[model samples]
Target: MNGVRGLLGVAVCTGLAGCAAETGYADLEAYLDAARTQATVQLEPAPTLRPVPTLSYGASALRSPFQLPVGASVADRQGAAVPGMNDPARVREPLEGFDIEQLQMVGTLSGTAGSFVLLRGGGVVYRLRIGDYLGRDQGRIVAIGDSRVDVVEVVPDGAGAWLERSRTLALKTHS
Candidate 1:
């Protein structure tokens, strides 16, 4: 038994020494050293932005820049009554309740009475003529042509004044 134990101890010590003396990792160690020397990274500085300049608007006393320019005549500016103003006593027309854009010119008619235009709105067809009022904006028909109907509309100019503007309703062409 003593001899067997002594041989086992010698074998263990010899195996440990053999493992420590081995040089199988020489290439791995050289590669690591070369990589450490070659590895390098460069960083760039961040960009800086300039501040925007501030401006102050001081046109409160003058006319507003956003409001439409008032083209009222001198008489109108002098407190005279403006033409095309809605009359309170006049009866409103059925087509006046509809917008000019909503009414499509469907056809035209000419007879002994006068020239007339047929307009369709809200699933109903209405006959109109020059001087007839239509649209919610107090629009009055001024002319009826073969392909379009011209109307003069009274609209507020954003300055407590009313202005007359021309609007055209084109005839609906079948697709």
Candidate 2:
């Protein structure tokens, strides 16, 4: 009885091994080939590059930074009243020490005598009127309007003669 049972177990194992060997993988191979045919691959085109532009620098048209600004001389022209030109010997005013661009017309004041322009600069407010001097370029107040102060500045034209230029200092409005 023991020998018969052992023989039956060996026969069942042999039958399973034979069935596994006969099984085919053709269906799996056909599925993988179909997936590869249906798949698509895309590649982008390369970007075009532009050439850099060449710049030409001309020094003749540019002003010299080492020298004083254009029309900075205060020498009097051959024949002109040039109010501030002949005043070199006189005492310089307090506001004359600062540049014209640094000063700002903040507001105005009126008194019994006349109206005065209020200039603020260097952390201090200054009251000035017509004929008063301000700015390093011998700038003199000529007219005071409602919102602006007109001034005549005498500056050198890079030569021995001086030139008079009109400048306006407007009241600053804050937002």
Candidate 3:
């Protein structure tokens, strides 16, 4: 029995020695060495930052947005009263009942006597000359041209004063 055990132990030792001498990992080790030599590791460069421009706001001298518009009454702004602005005793004319915007210049009549402007308002035609009063706001005709009539009106400025406003009534051309 001791001799049989010695032979089995010697056979096991011989099989292990043969396996150690012929290892199958030689190809795998060669492939790993080749891959390591061909491999590369690179890092990208860091980015650069630019400086921002400094801007200064320049609207300190302008009017504030929270305040009202820069406008005052004619009497308050001018610091004086307009002479002969609105006469209360003046007689009203036929066209004084209508607004100046409602009157339309239809035609112009020029004769040996003087030139006249024909206006149509409220389905009625009227012949107006320079210095004639019209419109509800005491508008006096100042010029009567061939295609238009200009008037100066005295209107309240909402500050217990009157201001002269120029209005033009253009001629009505039929298509």
lDDT by residue for model 3 over 37-146, one digit each (tens)? 99596878778878889888799888876553478444464575554445677667899999888888999999987989999889999998898989988888889898
Task: Identify the candidate with maximal TM-score.
Answer: 1
Per-residue error for 107 in candidate 1, Å, reads 1.3
Worst 10-residue stretch by lDDT in candidate 2?
A: 73-82
Per-residue lDDT tens digits of candidate 1, residues 56-101?
7887678777654478454454365446576888889999888788
Per-candidate Cα RMSD to the true structure, in Å, reads: 11.7, 14.1, 17.7
Clashes of each: 0, 1, 0
- Evaluate model 1: give its TM-score: 0.61
Q: Per-prediction TM-score, please?
A: 0.61, 0.54, 0.53
* lDDT of candidate 3 at residue 136, scale 0 to 100: 87
**lDDT by residue (tens digit), candidate 2, 83-122:** 6476668888899999999999998888898999999879
Off by over 4 Å in 1: 1-40, 46-78
Q: Candidate 1's C-alpha lDDT?
A: 0.85
Native-referenced Cα lDDT, model 3:
0.83
